[model samples]
Target: MSAPAREVRDVARAALAWASGRRADFALGEDALAADGQVDRSWKPLGELAQVCATVTRHTPPGDPLHARAADLLAFAWRQTGEGELFLRLQRLEPFATYPLEVYAALAAAGFRHPAYEAATATVARTRGWRLTEQEPTRRLGVLHAEERGGIHRDEPREPALRRTWLGGLPEPWTFERSAGYALTHVVFHLTDWGRAAGGVPGDLTDYLAHWLPPWIDTCLDARMWDLACELLAVAASVPGLPGDTVPDDAWARVAAAQDASGALPEEGDAGDPAAYFAHHYHSTLMAAFAAALTAGQGVPV
Candidate 1:
């Protein structure tokens, strides 16, 4: 392997190691069951952990160290969800809430099935309440993906949902901003099922992404938006034959340099309070691991 490729793989490995070490910090709180209490702090992090670990397991061949690390992490995360029982309870607690199913989908995709939860969601999926629920285009796509993984038939066709997104318009390149950047990355993510289905990205959108994604990556890096930049990098890797290298080695080097000794990546230029480290840096660290894992799938499996 070339030096750059190996370095990128190291980034993936280190980031995953950091995440696995901090698995306990991802626990849900007492308020998690309350309607006012949300999953953003607790369930969100665990779900992100599950999602990235599953993605790593998906891209890496079995028996590889990275695959094993990710698998172990996935198992730990599944246990955190009470072996999928928490989702069933969450569904019963909030029948109309989609986050439980959203979080459940990641585990579900990685060979972790919850029959009771799936069965309950299947019945809910047929209800008018679930069908007519309003979500922004990106979230709508997420729900569809969750439904697919949860064994609930999709409430809406994906194509229309795709077109409704900010990235769907193929808007003026100059109009891109912070929120748009994230929205665009997620649009690509959901379209490709977190890079598992590259063909899900349309030819036109793929071409557009190929042409424009590099600058967006560079832009994020320039602003030190490591989390979103890594996310954008994953989008680039998700597209097949995405022309020249989507992120130049130096950019990858910058990302690697930004990584802490423990393998966690900061969301911005500097790591903030140590006490709040997980809250501030978990997502970006997860993104780095995710990008490296997906990129590693391109040539030699990492």
Candidate 2:
């Protein structure tokens, strides 16, 4: 069966309505300054809207019409959420078909796609911008995640690798692949890095990853980010001796052996193929729990 042609207009409208109200707290009025001088409720609306965009983007299938529209929405919301890196990253990832229809409708209906959106996303090299460089190598490495180039030598600069780096020390370009290769390598690399930094042991890797992941995740309202977090967690479990992995099968049973000893099981019916699951559904829920746990000084089981 074929995919829908995308209710490109509808998605664009949704994105706009969600984004339009984000600045009131940061507006010129009294609300902008909470006397405490911190950016107040301004962040809440923006964070909520960014999650909505991420939710839509996570559920929409790649190559679907709405998918591209959602990507543009993802871009806009990321700006509102103050995560310009994710905004530009997602903008660069927005497929071509979603642009003409989605962006056009948004431009027609809503002045311009957010003032900050344009400024931040203006320079992404789309298909129109793909350029062949003559200053480099002879070998071709096929496709890339966030860069315009197709090939890289073994000794190539690590800058491109750094662009997609985010939560749990995994890079988006690598993590987005959702493969055993990406998962295993990603966890191992981070574990190794964390372990090495902690005098070549696992003593404090959890603290570092836990401490570093949330802020790096920025507005963890997006569902995709949450799903990514789960995958990372699962990857951690798969490692030979992490808490979740090291614990025997009986340990989880024991953890759940007494109702009083265990917290409620994650509101049921979440099991599925982790790689194939829609990122939007599980991302926010996962992050919310993760955040709540962090606030209460808890940790994921490996």
Candidate 3:
């Protein structure tokens, strides 16, 4: 039910290799550069690449091949944002929109800095409007963490925010559904700082997840929902005392099997429409890399 560290490291390297080869595709389009046009297509993907690659670089030390490649990919992703200037420009263009800051947080946490963006964001953070911005519970947690990552103080408390989330409530296990699954995983991600702060997950929720995550992951796998399944796997890896028991041998094997030889993972059972491949499956592939890096970084033999 397990593989050596190198096996999981191979998974991490392959996924980053694939991402590095596709680096150009993650660039900001002309429209996105000028305005908020096609953000989901342009900005979101780029941000995700930065986030996952940053995690890979953080977990893998400098000498390792995986670390070197992941660092290269992370640097490439940073360039796509014009070396942090683009985020500053976007902050001006969409003062209320938090995506730019949220995306910037990944790089910021990885030691990439943008003084102008930080100053502007700090000014905004002091506004009453910023504090009162309406957001779903999970996203609210995201913004709070983003502010924290950038060293901008938000006059808000996190515990109350946690108590408001779907995962925070420790909701009925059977009521779990697709949208709710993503919500819960993100809750874990934000709570644990995407596995950097494993103890951040409350003990009760840790126990709750230890009991429920396996079946939840199985359900995603059963539905052939590779993306969410990978996300759920990431949740398992992020929680303290969960990885050894929660991540089943077959779960990693199934996810690994779904990965293309080129390292892209399909959203579902298979990679559909080769012509639009990366567009269709980029997030899932990124999730696979994210999960793999976290799994391996924890020193768990997957």
TM-score each candidate.
0.96, 0.23, 0.95
Kindly report which residue stretches of model 1 are placed more than 4 angstroms away from their true locations once superposed.
none
lDDT tens digits, residues 239-289, model 3?
A: 878746576667777787788899888888898999989887889988988
TM-score of 1: 0.96
Stretches of candidate 2 off by over 4 Å are 1-37, 57-112, 115-302
For candidate 2, give the lDDT of residue 294. 21
- 10 residues in a row with least lDDT, candidate 1: 293-302
> How far in Å is the alpha carbon of 19 misplaced in model 3?
0.6
Q: Residue 94 of candidate 2: its Cα lDDT?
A: 50
What TM-score number comes out for model 2? 0.23
Specify the highest-TM-score model's number: 1
Query: RMSDs, each prediction?
Result: 1.3, 17.1, 1.8
Q: What pairs collide in candidate 2?
A: 141-151, 226-283
Give all candidates' CA lDDT scores. Answer: 0.87, 0.31, 0.84
